[model samples]
Target: MVHVGRPRERVGITRRSLFGGVAGVGATALLAACGTSTAPSAPSAGSRSADAGGGPSRVVALSTGHLDHCLALGIVPVGLAVAVSEATDSRGIPDYIKQAFGDRYDLDSIQVVGQRMSPDLEKVAGLKPDLILSNKRADKGLTEKLTGIARTVQTNGGSEQFKADLKIVAEAFGKAADGERLLADYEGRARAWGARRGTPGTFSLVRGKGDQYLYFGTRALASIVGTDAGLTRPAAQQFDEAASRTLSLEQVGLLDADWVFYSFPGNSGDFTEAPLWKKLPAVAEGRAFRVDVDPWFLNASTVAADRVLADMQRFMST
Candidate 1:
């Protein structure tokens, strides 16, 4: 679950979820700065919303999928777990969210509870949200700990998890009707975009982590959304796993397809200097382009999916 911010073209940042720890505001600092609550922070997912009748509710989201689902549905979380992924910033609001829903809502001001992988439970306790949203990918004991403090519900994963998460969260806030509409709208938009793109072609998602590169499979967020938008993938890269495949620099040829999108851990640096990069057919044809990994790579939310589809639309139009 990753939330993505705005995209700055040509900026390279790896969106793969691999790291020792996430950087976040400490509990002590958050308490000193954001106030504390002696009471339980929130209710479990099955509980009803404490928000005003017919108005938006406050949510505490543990995963990027939860955060983006609520935000796309117009329910800004009171506090959200930030990620070290290139998709989000220090505040955890991805640049794409700012660009897509900036006028509909102001997520930038939302409080940061902790990092997604290693949330500062103390800081989340201080936020005092009425509800908490998490998913199954959390470490074994962590979800139970979250439920102890608040009403937490685990969202499922897979290609359709984005829609499923919205349904769960929308019903929590008495926005079930709206959630259905959002899903319909997404399906309609995806279908229309697919029709517009017309031609079928293979897409390759590449991640550069120093000398060894990783190729995304069917389960990666962006790849899932792209496939839904009628984009095909290289047969060799298609697999049921969500994890990526790491290959040495000499194996760059394996990532070739009709189109290839590359994301780097920070900046691509002078990657073109690598001998294998030029051998890829997409590079020679200029079909391989650099993209911001935040919104395009670890993508799992409706907002990021929209951004990805919009990008494909632009590319297809050309």
Candidate 2:
């Protein structure tokens, strides 16, 4: 169901069917904006190109994941769409990103075009950006609309394809070598960290939101990082076809592991307080810790991967 720019190629598989019947009950909509999208506005000459040599500079990030990729490649977007968590932030940038960029960039100045699901096309057009970085979340209709405003590039998958996504984003920005090097560096660091840890026991990743508990699978950012670090996943979380498996509080024991990392969009009480949750070995042993949803669940680039690795080290030690 995800399509991108022409010559009319299908860039991503449909995530709709991947989550079982969640799409029918509006849960998929909630997850759809895991990243954000841009809006439309009038295109101007200023938006055409930021350089005399036809290189893109005034880029508009249609998704936060793409935004992370841009930042990783040393590019600060002229504008970006934000996820719900990001929209709530006064600065419109995630805290991890703020700390990562530090004073090297002015985070507040980047215009927030709109939410991921509903980008303000007019605002995006108003920015007159030369490039638009998005994921497959930008449908054919949105892609056409975006192409009219600026050159648009979308990767094949969302967080599920972070490696390929980062490479695609880097290529679009004309930094293929840098992108490859970044990936290699991340792989090296992850392996080195794994080696230092010797044989850490299985790690479990869960997310609490509303009434449901999400068990991350192979496609999730944290899961991917765990694999890179040579960590093991509980059998329930070993699959790759879907991003995650939705579990009811009654099934909390399925998330049990030697170490458990859980995060929520806000407070963690929703699914964490259930009776089954307390019975989990990790929870009983005080090995479960709450984590931030931004880099762990939302952002899926090298920058976020690094944060996930650091978080793993910190949480495992505690």
The candidate that achieves the highest lDDT relative to the unseen native structure? 2
After TM-score superposition, the amount by which residue 130's alpha carbon in candidate 1 deviates from its true location, in angstroms, is 1.8
Cα-based TM-score, every candidate = 0.77, 0.80
Report the lDDT tens digits of candidate 2 across residue range 220-277: 9888898888898988888888888887767787887898888865555667677888
Computed on alpha carbons, the lDDT of every model, listed in order, comes to 0.63, 0.68
Q: Best candidate, TM-score-wise?
A: 2
State the lDDT of candidate 1 residue by residue for 1-318, as single tens digits: 222222122111111110001123233432222122221112122212333473334467887677767654445576788777645567777665655445444455567877887788987777665577877878879988887777776777544467677788778777676667666655566665676668878888888765556788887777776777788889878886555888666777788798888877655445666778887888888887666676677657665665666555545444
The lDDT of model 1 is 0.63
What TM-score does candidate 1 reach?
0.77
